[model samples]
Target: MANVLVCIKRVPDLGGEIRLTADAMGVDDSSLGHTVSPHEEAAVELAIQTAKDTGGEATVLTLGSEDAVEQLRNALALGCTGAVLVEADAAAYGPADVAAAVADVVRDHEAAGTSYDLVLVGNDASDTGDFQVGVRLSYLLDRPVVAGVSTLSVDGGEVTARGGSPDGGTEVYQVALPAVLTVMEGGVEPRYPSIPGRMKAKKIAIDRVTPTGEPQGSGRRRLTLPPAQPSQVTVLGEGPEAAGAVVDLLESLGVTR
Candidate 1:
């Protein structure tokens, strides 16, 4: 039996009008439309493509409030076999706490005889972009993890992943089964859900699990936008003299001369 689990998150649409309240703590989600986080979106696409390729089942899991059901439908519409929703509010936990919650979910699944051959997650959340969840989750689950995966494939109980490094190069890795992978954005292009798929996914049932940890980080500090940089102005000079002045100005500004 081939089983796969994909973890996803519902995030506010950055393109839409997003406002920071006076408190600067949370987002004004009143008029904000929500979608899967970009990294998570890519994970879903990879999950769907993997399922199609291997002819296996894919399950998506998320932890959110009641409204998070929409995220499940979104994943199902992308062709997941099932969805699991860990019933927690939006501000439920910090990264550490969320990792614990996911560990509990994995334990519950294991106890219930639901085993997974592979677990997938996004590289990081859009808001925090800590890039720690997948690594933490792997440690919690006692599984090997490969982060920053741009290409992934499974064959005969072995998995091969190609990840991009900082120096514009790709590294290939091979690992055994029961591993966790965090996918990057350029791994694969996501497919649009068909109308029929959307309708079917809407009616799909989501299993709700009560996570162990009470919402952590709810009392944490709020969000604050970083100071914006001023636009650049170019000063023109005459030939070599102008170039020397430009170099001097760049050196004074601590920029490469």
Candidate 2:
């Protein structure tokens, strides 16, 4: 089993209608629930599986408010062995800021005489859709990074990854361990947490850490939602009386005259 560290973000559950904030800097998440993206869910599943395969442990980490623990616990319930919380306002941290923060944690682990063989992150951010964190983190830690990965397996000191290419083909890579990877969804199906797992996760302790410096900030101006696509549904008629109308409608379309 490989010692794995998987980073995740807490994002608004965008399943329902979205309402933008007055400043347009973000959505009105005050009333919205929170969860991780499907991509991160898969990453979590992969992390646990990788650790189990290599005889190591999987750790889930996040930089967010106190409530973000809900998501961490969700991963724990799914089988992560440990969890870490970097207490900070996630909305206030930009890609570069959080990347540095994660790097700090990695260094801390090394200084404590422990190290992880793999670091995983969602290929794209859930709320912001930014694809910069994984690359930045790997740079800060001076590790090779593979992005947009859909599947991966760890064997001894090397990890093999597969992803999609621009030409609708598959791109495969075999990189050494102590690597960073950004995972995308679709290659594997995430498993649900069992009742026993959930109960066990609730009892495990989550390690907490705080940011050491102020965020450098971002130049992002605003967020804009695309215009809604127009759609319409027409009902021809109902029951027995609709047959003639349906035939007439088809004839109007030149299908059945």
Candidate 3:
């Protein structure tokens, strides 16, 4: 049976005002409620759907404090076969650090003889928005990486994918298996957890494993808000004189014609 690993994160709700530790390196999880990153959720759903199609199991992994288990459970509810938690006392890591930790987790799984056919992660996490994790993981795994994928299909050891383009067009590519895929949101709407799914997920067992590697980037930094700016008002021109005034105002504002 094909095996897949879906990576996810527990991030602060966007609606809430998030305050990072003074270090600015880590989030202040103590005061924030957690929710799954939307892009990661889409990746998980795609993994689950792919598993259903390809005949295998989708395993979920996350690295954070114990509270992150909540988001893992949410993944379980979404039909993942099982969950693994990489525990850390103090949640702190930059993109590079987090990527290293994640690579270690994948290596652990590989060493245990539980190699996956594919590793799936979001194009970008919601918090830091660093989009390098999947590519780094692909490098660590020594596998081909297809990123910004919005659609995916696997068949007979070959895969096909589509991604957004800088030219405002869609680009598609085909690659071999054992690849890392960074799924972009809007490929598919993530399935909502139903009552039955939640019930089953709550009962599903989650295995805890000791996380590998030291936490990186623990140095503290200050929190500063952006400078506020006054709002601009648009005044409609009524005639030639009004239009000339508007032109003069635009020139004053340094807006070139």
Among the numbered candidates, top lDDT falls to: 2
Name the lDDT value of residue 118 in candidate 2: 93
Worst 10 residues of 1 by lDDT: 211-220
Q: Please, what are the lDDT tens digits per residue for candidate 3 over residues 74-154? A: 999889988988786534676667667778877888898888888999999887678898998888879999999888888
lDDT of each: 0.83, 0.92, 0.82
TM-score of each: 0.84, 0.89, 0.82
Among all windows of 10 consecutive residues in model 2, the one with the lowest summed lDDT is 228-237
Q: Candidate 3: which pairs clash?
A: 22-221, 23-220, 23-221
lDDT string, candidate 1, 118-179, tens digits: 78989998866778988988999999999998778888787898999789999999999888
Judged by lDDT against the true structure, how good is candidate 2? 0.92
Cα misplacement distance, residue 230 of candidate 1 (Å): 10
Best of the two (1, 3) by TM-score: 1
lDDT of 2 by residue, 78-194 (tens): 999999999998878889999999999999988997798999999997787889899999999999999999899998899999999999999999999899999999999999999
Better candidate by TM-score, 1 or 2:
2
In what order do the candidates fall by lDDT, top score first?
Answer: 2, 1, 3
